[model samples]
Target: MALPNRLRRLLLGSDPRLARMLGYWAATCLLYFIGAALLILQVRAGAADHDSAVLLIGIGATGVAVFAVLVRASIVMGIAPSTLAAWQALFAIACNIGAYVVTGPLRGVYLIFLLVVLVFCTFSLRPRHTMLLCAYTLGILGATMVWLVATYPATYPAYVEGVHFASAACALISVTLLTGEMSKLRLRLKQQKEDLLAAMATIRKLATVDELTSLANRRHMNEVLVAQERRIDPAGQPTCLALIDLDFFKSVNDRYGHAAGDAVLRAFSAAARSELRAQDVLARWGGEEFLLLLPATTMTQAILVVERMAERVAAAPVAEISGGMRITFSAGLAQRHDREPFADTINRADKALYNAKSTGRNRISLG
Candidate 1:
């Protein structure tokens, strides 16, 4: 395990994808060794000449070294691994076919290894490409069989080559079809996994976001406040909370339609978002009421932010179809005391908000 890990680091650098593809490349190189061994075995059986087997072994060894270098270079250059793997597949098929043509009486051994080529391709190539390689293998081997029967009828009888070709074709085509089905299954499973992840993300967004205003909903805001309460720092800048209520919002719905009332709320939320600082949070606290959280803000700064938000709302027509009526919200601000419970600070702000509503509709009051 340690040696393979070190080899992967040295050869493939740090990319796990590259390392996996290199493993496939190594298997094809191993097939080259197996082919050479088969040929050497045939030489000992007197089915192929010693000189021919030795020469082919040397060529196979050199081909492995060359492709290893090419694979290493492709990894370093960030080239697509499949592209080089395609080239290696072609090289392997050609070498396997050459070995089959030379191995006299024991050439059928190389036909079995041709199926190994298709298996390699099932992992490395697209299904269609693998099937295409299968067809190429059939065509080339058919041609070789015809040539062998004509040139060396004593060694490769016509009926013998025919049976060999038929058997090899059956095995190759069967594996190709199986690999095609497997590839589709793998693709379908991957797409379903992606869809599941996306649906989970949508569920999370609906949990946090208000349906109408797209602001944080009440439950999510409470979670934020609870988190904020846990991390209060006395020496750090103060945090402020403001409870805001839309003035006469029920009357607006009574005068105009609910659609116009909804439009006003949406437009007001948009404006509030634009006016608030990035660190601030505003939540829709159910039906024309909202809570604003201003981190690192004093009461004075919170009041200024609330006042600016009020002026911005008055400057724009929140509901153009409702005679372009301006909207106003009364707010009450409270600077959070160190170690004070968040609920108590909110209660003080809510109480002060009632005072602002009782005195005048558009003004802010500090708690």
Candidate 2:
């Protein structure tokens, strides 16, 4: 048999963290590949010593692969996702700066390549972590500048100064591009999440709440009542039920209109909801009728609650109608004192409600 949508989502589509982890790992691997390839090409092109070129490429590739593995492992162990990404970016920045320190930033376009990798790392990581990594990177660059000025002033002569300036420009440009892309992606993802939550809320309301009265609907009520029955003590404490019916509800519709009737219903619902205890479950059983289930309440207590609610409804003014139509409700209370079936309890409540209606128009009765 085919799985239901909810089951499918829970089983196959709900693991967001896995996607994030895998995506990050894949991007890291891709960056490593690009950086390694560039390093190999750069070394070969600028090889005053051919043997050094092969050795440099092999060593750089192995070190980067090891770093990638360590970063991924650390993330899998116990690190927070954002923190892991930040550490990964920091490691990348450290690698780049370490290369610059060893191989002279004046090496034709090598600093530019390192700058690109640094930008990639910054953009790929979380914002606060990225900032910290950038600060560390800038510190490395500053230290490198100071070292060059102090020790190798002649090495980066007037000709090499232009190369260094161009390298800085490359770094700035790369950072700007990647930062812009990352920001846009973040905004899109956030909006998508908000939209998804709103849709879920709407779906939940449709499933569990009455559209007009905004009370728990029949389905939700059934779920709650069944769950309550499982935990209810038959011989221990009483379970009370209140069946409420709006008096002259059909006349309200006939006198004013359906819209005015809706207004009256909403007003009564609001009042009844406010009067209910936090533990009481209120449900719209059907049109013009509502049910309140109160566990661990005696028949007397339930009748008192019903009387108070009836008075409250009688006092609360209905919303504007064509005529000044007053609104009132009749309530019936029933409590299970001994072992009794759920249906019998509800039937007793209905009988009490009928008695309330028969005795007077607006009053409470108990059975």
In model 1, what is the error at residue 153, expressed in angstroms?
A: 3.1
Which consecutive 10 residues in model 1 have the weakest lDDT in total?
A: 316-325
In model 1, what lDDT does residue 107 have? 81
Candidate 1 on 101-202: residue-level lDDT in tens?
Answer: 778777888888888777777665778888888899899989988998899898889999999999999999998899878876777887999999999998
Candidate 2 Cα deviation (angstroms), residue 328: 1.8
Best by TM-score: 1
User: Which residue ranges in model 1 land beyond 4 Å of their true spot?
Assistant: 1-16, 36-85, 123-126, 232-235
TM-score of 2: 0.61
lDDT of each: 0.85, 0.70
Candidate 2 regions exceeding 4 Å error are 1-153, 157-179, 232-235, 319-325, 337-341
Q: After superposition, how far is residue 353 of candidate 1 from its true place, in Å?
A: 1.8
Question: For model 1, what is the alpha-carbon lDDT of residue 296?
Answer: 92
Worst 10 residues of 2 by lDDT: 101-110
**Model 2 lDDT tens row, 129-208:** 45555556666666666676567677655546555645665575557557756866886898999999999999988999
